[model samples]
Target: MHDPIFSKSFTRTQRHRFGAIFLCFIIALAISKPPLHLLSPIGDAVKTQLSINNVGNMLLVDDGGRANIKPIADVNPAEYLQLPSDDAQNKRTSTTISAYSDNGIKMEKKHAIICKNSNYCKIEGDVRIDAKSSTILVATSFANMTKSWCVIEPYPRRGTSRVKKWRVATLEKNDISLPICTQHHTHPSLLFSMGGFTGNYFHDFADILFPLHLTSSQIQKKVQFLATDYKQWWINKFDKILNKLTKHNILDIDRETSQVHCYNELQIGLKFHKELLTLNSSPSMHTFKVLLREAYSLKRERVIRDINVPMPRLMIIDRKRTRVLTNEHQVLRIARKLGFEVVEGVATDLSRFAEAVNSCDVLVGVHGAGLTNMVFLPDNAVVIQVIPFGGVDGFARLDFGNPAKGMNLRYLEYKIRENESSLSRKYSRDHPILRKPELYRNWDQVWSIYLNQQNVSVDLRRFKGILVEALTLLYYK
Candidate 1:
């Protein structure tokens, strides 16, 4: 009764001391050993703090107080993160190797497969590139042969097998023959050849980038590229498209022939169906056109047919040497008379040229590699292929006509008459090179005369009708 204040202060001090001792005990208990029964509660508390929810089956409580938990056999760990209702997510589940630890948590392992067909060879999963030997090493327990190897030329065209070849081998775990990995990449690798007909504008897209887009679009830009027969100019030329295709830097396998680069997943070679066309595929020509527009940051998706302007912009692909438009000025005059703003698609940097091509509503060109720029044209645009006079409609149609429809463009064939061809001026009408040119079925024969040495002077009256038709297609259909 004499010192009530002193008694209250003493009680507060004892409570503070007891709180500190309890906190220390909790910390020491966590450091020493975790009890199986307490693990779920501890994990739940942490999850709650992190605002994590619906992580089903990842945290199993040991209700029986047993130290061991049964492993989830052959079940992919990524599946647990998604809800059962997410079907699309399940289908796009990333390739992963799954294992189980003593605590029943999923661990990762090496899994690989080398799938080969007549068209291409696709190697995926835990892969290593030994540049010293120009070989690709895959790690997997599924290698039944103890050691197995196959040589693959990772290009789309089989005609370029001599350009480059890569040795792919499947090695068992703990194989002493494995090369030391100098670098590790978190993302998957896409390996292909830049050798086969890459310099040509047609082959650049038809053979390499088109097939590459078909193959890599499924990965959602999570892959890096490894190119054999690599060219810096080619890389720079398609930098914009490459940027849309991948976020990682491109590695030149030929130049860096000393490092051993390893990746969790690697895909050797691209998937190619046919040249310049995608048939019954997931990424159809329309989808590819959308990708191209997005990659170039093109402003137009369709040809502008505004009531205020009422005139469409036209692009004439002017070739310098072969298949030159001899009377280009008259063609320009006719196009202008019909209310078309004309511009020439000439040789320039690719990025700049792509923009110029996309801005136009109609693309006019002779059947040549320059017409390949139609890949950059807007949807519903018109492509007028002026076929040189050589009885080569089938060849010209195969090259540009059929693919134009696939890209959602209106294709028009303007077959130049004999009088319009420079070959007509050089030779007589009854000459076999002109009159009976159908006899030359071989491409080598056709290439030397009609393709290699030809120029066109369009019949003004007939060509004007083609332009009129192009205008009708733009506005009406």
Candidate 2:
């Protein structure tokens, strides 16, 4: 009953509408689901372009200390897909990657790949990462490839910000579409990387060794001694003791930044004194003293000498830093008059220094790093520490008193009376520097006014009594 042409037109229109609806449904499904390209293996080029989350956004620096960071488009999931956790059926996978440095030095060129997760990627084995100004040594089964290329959690306390300045990359792989990015870098060597001339002799020579001592117990079997190029008088002489304790497994990675496995700790200061006390079979004091004597080839019988013949030598440490003797010439004159040999205490030749200290019966020094050389003295030697002002009583006892007692050495501290300090000349008698000594609770303020800037002239008449006391202990004991 309807016109045939009109019926055909209506049927064609219905078919066109149905086809458009089906196409729209297909588009929606495709949008909701992951792309098929994500399922396929990623290409090598795509891997190289993989975005490194926190560490990846680095400013690529050139040889002349210039950074060149190009603006790349945001990564697409289809082009750069994260591998499934069970991609290889949870099987352990391994790969190698090269780590580049700003100076074109390649550190850990071949790193063993471990695994990756959403938050972090781990690299198996030890690695050293170097930057323009710093070198880091990491020791762990796996390294973090996320925020910071750190193996140890919480990173190193001293160089946390410096560690973040590294630009890391991975060598191309054939089987894997993305290069298994490893977190490692390299530098010229440990010597240049440790530090430059700090101008602080105490920090340069003595305080530097404290961190190495902190790693004694954490080092299970091996120690890769770095910065051997800086080895000089004291380091060369005392390294024999280190060699004996570490059992000669101290491999020298000289002039190159390196990370040795099985060693786990590094810290500054004598904060680990308690831990150091428990390291070896014997007490640390006895063990260290014996090792030192062995290194210098001295006998126990030689330490104890005849009291009447003046066979024992006395050495006085003359400091070149703060809190020094204002009238050192006069002090030296008195020392010589008392038949004590006054040594400069600062030695460029460690062998000569060792010989001088080892031969002496009494070692005397103001409260400074120079006193650290007392380690070279004979077992029963007497140590006279001249304590500076500003409430150093407790600190003096903790720093040297306990250690000397432990090492079987007679320790004597000469506290500086107010009249003896040079501060008395500069500040008014009623000034806070003179009166409110309790304000020394702030270490920096105390250091500025008393320890770092002040000097002293010992009241010779009063100091002679302490000198006599030291001699009595050395002669009688």
Candidate 3:
């Protein structure tokens, strides 16, 4: 309405005032509104702001909303975090977190969730935890709020009527629940599954019995036994002795089955040999000797009668596989020369074999399965283990010396010299096979080449001293 310059100025002033009001309103709105973290997805919000550089010692937020957490010595800002929401609308299908125990056993939890407010972590879906030996624990739900205790609910078996009567028994009825809950402070019951027969005498027969010797008295009453080979006749015979020793019922389990829950497990090896030797006062040794006597119907008087004789009856184990005595005739000639009644043959009958071994004063054999027959020997008997080349310190001790000590047999090792080994003929002087037996990349190859395929040529001059030692031990004992 006024002059053109004045009108333009008024219009510009009005526009500037409106723009300033709008800018003020936008700034006010932004300042009053809640944070983006409250409105957006939790994982996305956390990923944007959270940085975890020391995941090994701190809680690691996983994509599935589960947190891999360790025990916190002192609470720090970084150690605590808000967990994702549990609203049905915001929930995802699954999540996982990896955890480790103080003993370094690794465990993985799947479909896990953590509550921020309560600090409780829950594991959902099927979870299997393996303890030592063949024992396993299966649970459907597990929760841990603190590092002190973990709560596990056993996975319910289908078609089971009673909650407490879940564990199925073969013959006897027990009202134990599946994944039976025991207090964290109380000692849980132990269950041992018979490791299947490895066929080797030392592995199958003698080694399996070692666990009975290794178990402590505190847990012995709570220990349960399970055997997979219930149908094998030899296993039945072996079970008799095991039952007598353990004084617990041995349950039969299906061959294909796996997974059991126990507080502890027994493994098969000579690692506990020293502990086993302390069981001389245990009834197991006496039961074992009695069972052997009953199995062959041998009179104790007869065994005693044989032991009292002056010359020791020496049975040189004839090998059918590896480490055969190449100079058996000369070796036998030498053995006979040493006043030993040498009994040598591939024993076809086990009873007769047991009887022969039981009657012997000294059992001589190259390190092999035949050496396991030393279990049948009487007390004060001598076991002359021929340490084939590459077997002096390793298999020789594990296979014989340790077990011989447990059986109360005097163990004598006859270490074969380099010249006695047949590998010298097949390999050159500078070859690794001849010089460095340990350098072989595969132990099985070394065993096959140096032990399984090779035979021994006893240097009679050198071996005589070992025989003399055996005689001295037998005579002195």
Model 1 per-residue lDDT tens digits across residues 205-228? 777888788878878689898988
Residue clash pairs of candidate 3: 136-260
**Candidate 3 TM-score, C-alpha based:** 0.53
- In model 3, which regions exceed 4 Å deviation? 1-191, 213-225, 229-250, 255-291, 294-310
Task: Report the lDDT tens digits of candidate 3 across residue range 292-353.
Answer: 56656554312233346765678887764467778878877887888888775456556667
**Model 2 misplaced regions, further than 4 Å:** 1-222, 226-271, 274-283, 294-302, 332-346
Worst 10 residues of 1 by lDDT: 38-47
The stretch of ten residues in a row with the least summed lDDT in candidate 3 is 155-164
1 versus 2: better TM-score goes to: 1
Best by TM-score: 1
Per-candidate TM-scores read 0.74, 0.54, 0.53
Residue 209 in model 1: lDDT: 87
> 1 or 2: which has the higher lDDT?
1
lDDT tens per residue, model 2, 1-477: 224444345444343344334433432332233321121110101112223231222111101110111112222222333223323312432223333333334445344422221111233334333422232333321222211221211111122121122222221223232222243222111111123111123332222343344334344224334432233433443466556445433333333343322212221112122211323444355655565566666544236766566645777776554677777677667767776666655564545676777778888777755665666777778898888777655555544665676667889888888888988998889988778676654434544566666688888887777777777886776
Clashes of 3: 1
Pairs with backbone N, CA or C atoms under 3 Å apart (clashes), candidate 1: none
